[model samples]
Target: MSGQRSDTECRGTHEWVSAAPFRSHLADLVGTTGLPWRAVALYADVPTRCVRSLLFGRRGRVVRRIPARVAERLLRVRAAQLNGLTARSGDAWAAHDLASRLAGRGQSAAEIALLARATRDEAALWLVGPPGWVSARSVLLLQAACHAAGMDWAGPADPWEPSPAEAAA
Candidate 1:
């Protein structure tokens, strides 16, 4: 049997979007921006290796799975470029955006945890805190949930870092 399954057979199932398609789309969008891969990685705070893996995909070696968070960040980067927005400091906005999307979908922390393969406390932490130190693995899971729900991973162009005033306070 082919790897493909009928929608009727997998109606309620959630499969991660294939990295190959995402990689292709990313390449196309990024190419339009005229920004180098290193520049994009630096601006987006994504690892260069992730970009290379997505773009090149281990020609004769074992393919690496593009982390969901990286893909989501790239989506945001593309949105920023398309919208003529400037790149910001950190990725806190991304976590906030994901949390907001999840909430808008009426998904609870427990549900997010289940989707992200994390504990309830961990999911809540990612949503409630300063977006500090979430594991890449969890991001992959959350990104999958976002995709399944038809949510836009690209968020508003809010500054992720605290303002100097806010930092001083």
Candidate 2:
């Protein structure tokens, strides 16, 4: 009677990792680098609010389910190498790096954009959310993904303005 119920039995509950580590990591990434907000936004496919949460270390809601396979595919590198690819080749590498970082941390679409190397507007577009927007949950997920990926990234500028060469691309 104690071990088994007449109709159903109680299962163990599971608690996932807290959002704090993730947020902190994101904040550090943002604070230390000069990566473009738009780039990060586009890469992560998240909104500004979620990005802000990660940057500011605020707690936001998060989606329970994660599309792990899709996330992994997005993070993985496809081709072996390119002959004359520059460091800023259409921001693809940057995006891929961001994706890898986010995938590692278990971040959602919103969180991805928020912490990417793009603008808030770009992030919102990627997330398909409104402009200048984000959520606490998205931030947490992004942080998680970055942590998972072991992305020790550092940007070159503050506010992430594109170089003249990159802008031309």
Candidate 3:
């Protein structure tokens, strides 16, 4: 504990807070990282739709406030952290390449998640560009997605390194 509040420390479980600071932080992330709203939101675990609405305005309506969790997560985000999510230690480059292939073939993030039986967050995190340090399961999910989509894909050539965990990206 460096006397700095941890990012995971939540003050209030249910509370409403001003959206201005969150919106401004997100805008700064986008400007600095040059990423789409979806990717940026995924990095911070915020609802992409809400972030989009907050930034762009929904139906000519201004968003005055957002959920405390949303604001907290958004505020915790750093510009460098917006680069993308990464696995702590697993299939480093394998999933990175596989995701790129799937993306190149015009597979939407949603489609990838559906085919892999994974969550949208996983798809967004791994499928985003120039990703490194991917989950071991990411290799499986992307491979499953490719096989399901009949993409004529091939996995990394160094033989399979099976992940101990179940596959969910």
Which prediction has the highest TM-score against the true structure? 3
Which candidate tops lDDT?
Answer: 3
Q: What is the lDDT of candidate 3?
A: 0.59
TM-score order of candidates, top first: 3, 1, 2
Q: Please give, for residues 1-169, the per-residue lDDT of candidate 2 as tens digits.
A: 1121211121233223344544444444444443333234323543333344444434454422222321222233122211112232333333444554554556665556655434444554534423343333333334334533545544212212234786698
lDDT of 2: 0.38
- Note each model's CA RMSD in angstroms: 16.4, 18.9, 14.2
For model 1, how does the per-residue alpha-carbon lDDT over 1-105 read when each residue is reduced to its tens digit? 122233234333233345776676667766776444544554465554556566766655534444455566776766445324222223445555676579778
At residue 66, candidate 1 shows an lDDT of: 49
Of the pair 1 and 2, which is ahead by TM-score?
1
What TM-score does model 1 achieve against the real structure?
A: 0.37
lDDT of each: 0.56, 0.38, 0.59
Model 3 lDDT per residue over 90-135, tens place: 4646565667678788977777666544577766776664354455
| Alpha-carbon runs more than 4 Å astray in model 1 | 1-93, 155-169
lDDT of residue 92 for candidate 1: 49
